[model samples]
Target: MAEMTQITPFVNCRDLAAQRRFFEDMLGFTCGFQADNYAFLRRDNVAVRLLEVDFNLDDPARQQMVYIDVDDVDALWAELEPALSKLPEGRARAPFNQPYNQREFHVSDEGACLFLFGQGIEPSA
Candidate 1:
């Protein structure tokens, strides 16, 4: 059996340049590799693949989503809050603890893919 190493989500976007800028500028992701049609972006251990695709209005597409596990959700939120508010639909909801015991916040890119940055909270002492 082949051992599973890692899972990287591929997101389809209309413009590679815009997608690359969003990840690099807004979310602090570094571009690992880039081609005309594809880009791989990384931050710490998380990697996201972006593919350039033509948007079809006739056939509506489902939004792509990625959850980035972070060491500190609040700190990330504090850093990202100001910039996130400027993009179209880029506003982030305040971080909150979930039933799953993770404190998380949601932000969307210009491409419409949602990213949830979260940190796992320990049980109360």
Candidate 2:
């Protein structure tokens, strides 16, 4: 049996340039490399390099998803609040009271894919 250690959930995007800008400028992801139809992105400890799906080699049909784990979901979302609000699909998760709870906000990238996620945790005393 093959053991799984790490996995990348890749998604297709329409434009590499546009998605690059959004991932870097908006999402604050660090650029790894860039070619004609492909680019790699990294953010902090998490990484799932992006590929600008090849039309000739593969299909560009839509499939929306990208979930990011963070130390503090609410705080991370707060930091992303302003820019997120501008996103067409951006929807705020209702506020709640709990110790280390789940909070999520959905937003669209430049290519209009429903991407970006935040998972937060409140430390125990």
Considering every candidate listed, which one attains the maximal TM-score? 1
Worst 10 residues of 1 by lDDT: 55-64
Candidate 2, superposed: residue stretches over 4 Å from native: 1-5, 54-61, 89-101, 120-125
TM-score of each: 0.83, 0.68
Q: Report how far residue 27 has shifted in candidate 1, in Å.
A: 0.2
Candidate with maximal lDDT: 1
Over 4 Å off, model 1 = 1-3, 57-61, 122-125
Clashing pairs in 1: none
Summarize candidate 2's per-residue lDDT along 26-63 as a digit string, tens digits: 67788788788877787777665566764542234455
Clashes of 1: 0
**Scored by CA lDDT, what does every candidate get?**
0.83, 0.64
Judged by lDDT against the true structure, how good is candidate 1?
Answer: 0.83
Q: What lDDT would candidate 2 get against the real structure?
A: 0.64
Lowest lDDT 10-mer window, candidate 2?
89-98
